[model samples]
Target: MLEISISSSLKDAVNDFKIGVIHYQNIVVDTLPPLIGDRLPLYYETIQLSLQEHPVSEVPGVAEWRSIFKKVGTDPSRYRPSQEALLRKIKKDGVPHFVHSAVDLINFFSVQHGIPMGIYDLDHLSEPIQITIGSDQDSYPGLNGRVMHLSGKIVSVDRTGAFGSPIVDSKRTCVTEQTTNALQIVYIRPSMELEEAKQLIQKMAEMFTQVHGGNHEWKLMN
Candidate 1:
């Protein structure tokens, strides 16, 4: 089993830096078919409905991520949560779509719930996912193949070095076609509750196993 732990520095900073980790086995994380297409109608409709509810800025989860970014000494405006960024684009443009199955599921959940989610290929990660504050000089290749700096940010690193944070996920461990085992993480701020994360994971896990043929287990690890 892989271990995931939080740092004292981060806990001292936010006092509520809680994270949920999930291990998925027998997953098919490839350039998936349009398996998630059936979800598009509902997904787009929900985003449209949400536009009537409130702006992304008024979202509690987005607000929490913004605060977390600030607490970690990063500029919240520059490194916005992936979900928040997607929401803004969708609100201005329209619902976006991805072809990868894992990406499809994760992004769908993010937009549906307005939370940030990251899924890494388990084979690419080192044991003991450590959550710690990043330094000014820390950098890694992003999923898009560009180098991303992790200066003054809260990040999670394995044996391969920093891979993910509230702002962005690294390219080294991004899920791919051959990623059968997945380490999925749903980022929740203190403003968010452990139970909330648990419920979301439970729902996603069910879909993953029943709809996508993956066996999974999950936990709420600080």
Candidate 2:
């Protein structure tokens, strides 16, 4: 059974932080059909246009990407690159590629929705996965052994602090074919209205099933 646990303190902080979630039930694993094959390239283009037209500042969860660019001493106005830019660069640069059905699913969803979503191998997770704010000293390893320093962002964290933000997945719990259970999280922030966010989540869930084809269950929490 899939299980989700949130700290009482974290739950209290949600309203204050203006964050909310529509989590699926842990025990229910439904695989929708896969539309990724037909839609990936188009969605990728859409994401690129969306980012170019709308600056990073306009996108939710992109503040971290902007901050990272700044920390590396890049000009936010001229050098700032959106997540789409980073992904495109990665694709063009011929970085070591890891292709899997779940990974592709997430990539397609990220582009289609303009929201960052993460999929974790559930067997590697501890009970009661949660959505909460990050601590001043919190950090987690991201793709390619890169450490994500999360000082001031609302994050969804597993008990081990393995996968905290939607920006990237931790190598520790990344999804693989061996992964029979999984946790998918979509970061919903203050910018999106509650109803709209729910709609997006449902759309994503349906899309996942459409592309992947599995039996899964869903749940929502405020």
The per-prediction tally of clashing pairs is 2, 24
Q: Against the unseen true structure, what C-alpha lDDT does each candidate score?
A: 0.78, 0.55
The sequence of per-residue lDDT tens digits that candidate 2 reaches over residues 1-222 is 355655465545444223223323332233323443555555555555655566646665556445443443334455333344445543444221336767766665554444566777777878667665467666777774778665544456766774756455677787766666667776554456767776777777776655555545555455
If scored against the real structure, what TM-score would every candidate get? 0.89, 0.67
Instruction: Give the least accurate 10-residue stretch of model 1, judged by summed lDDT.
Output: 28-37
| The best candidate in terms of TM-score | 1
Best by lDDT: 1
Colliding residue pairs in candidate 1: 30-177, 142-171
- True-vs-predicted CA distance for residue 94, candidate 2, Å: 12
- Model 2 segments beyond 4 Å from truth? 1-35, 46-98
Q: Write one digit per residue (lDDT tens) for candidate 1, span 1-222.
A: 568889898888888778778889987665434556766756676786777679787787787788788888988787888888878877776676565778877877787777788888888988878888987766898765678788788788887689987667898888888888988787765666678767877887787666558788988766
**How far off is residue 147 in model 2, in Å?**
2.2
